[model samples]
Target: MALLDADARHPITLPDGTLYRDTVYLKNVIDHPRIKVGDFSYYTHSGKPEDTAAILAPYLGHSVRERLVIGKFVQIARGSYFITSSANHPMTGFTTYPFRIFKPETFGYKDLPVRDTVVEHDVWIGHNAAIMPGVRIGTGAIVAAASVVARDVPPYAVVGGNPASLIRMRYSDDIISELLSIAWWDWSLDKIEANLDALTLGDMEALRRA
Candidate 1:
């Protein structure tokens, strides 16, 4: 069966004939008020009827008031949701009721904090993960499936579990620093393809040489 309707607007199909839902579409994302998804990064469906292209922003937990800036080469698996800043209701007060939301003229939306959620390059967000508001996921970090990330993740770290804690670093500090310095993702397509072997398996020295 066809995954998406033939009349689907601005459908993005991969080389393998996989059609990504509307949330991952660059054109649609660029038009979004608070979400900025970079090149080569796309969202997948979780095989639920609620995971439709019609309401991609809500499905991904995006807020119209807060910013969600995702960098290049990010691998975001299916069912990954970003809990944006707008999700947080004012709790410092006696009641959690947001009267300001209803009375824009009297209180305005200034009471709501808008934290920018930043996901750096080459980060791998596994399936069913929920990234909390204001969290900055560093470059090359891996968020394991079903994890609930509530804090900032350092570069090259692997995190998992509820209130996700760092499990381990992907590489030694020196290697990670070197990789960051190289910034391979910024390279041209042809150049990157040429160094694919070194990037995937060989040492940093090999990548540098390439």
Candidate 2:
């Protein structure tokens, strides 16, 4: 039962208006080797494992039993939504309130796809963006705030919109390729912590050259 504070932001506060000198809610969901969840990185529906599984699925959902999968250095912000399994109503009841029935196939229900979501290394997703199932936001990519991403995003691209369209590339393809080659996130935590100052303000090439 050890967990990490997603951030070293402020004095820890529990959900019930009760203040704790040292505690947090993210400790249990964090079990990754390379990724660090900044204190502000949050799950919209923290109470539902099914939802967190879909949102963090890229990092934690694999092993057959677990359904999330995430890569190194992913930065998820508050108000960002990650989806795993979806709730559906029955078929013939489309006009009714109960959403048809549990199993549409029981009445020839069409199966809806369960898509896995992934945010790769060094990726920065802005606040309030909603990433849908089966979407892979690639390494080094940036998704702008309030975007509704519904498909796979390529690496190093900047995307924003209601349904998330690629705005443009943040850097030349060559530079991105070089950064990919450098792979700084794969370095040991000690190395990164030691060079944190340099890594935060500069480019990957600078780190490699250093």
Taking the tens digit of each residue's C-alpha lDDT, what string does model 2 give over 1-210? 113333433234579966553222332455644223432233433335334434443433333221345566566665676654333233353453443244554431235445445677777778888777668888889999989888899999999998999999988888788778877777666666666767778656458765
Model 1: per-residue Cα lDDT over 1-210, one tens digit each: 433322333356778987554335332334555667666665666443344322334522333556778887787777777877665778787998867767647543455676788999989999889888889999999999999999999999999999899899989999899889999988776777777789888567789786
Model 1: runs farther than 4 Å from truth? 1-30, 46-65, 104-108
TM-score of each: 0.79, 0.63
Which structure among the candidates has the greatest lDDT? 1
Candidate 2 residue-wise lDDT at 51: 40
TM-score between model 1 and native = 0.79
Query: Once superposed on the true structure, which residue ranges of model 2 sit more than 4 Å away at CA?
Result: 1-27, 30-66, 85-111
- Residue 77, model 2, lDDT: 62
Count of residue pairs whose backbone atoms collide, per candidate: 0, 20
C-alpha root-mean-square deviation, candidate 1: 5.5
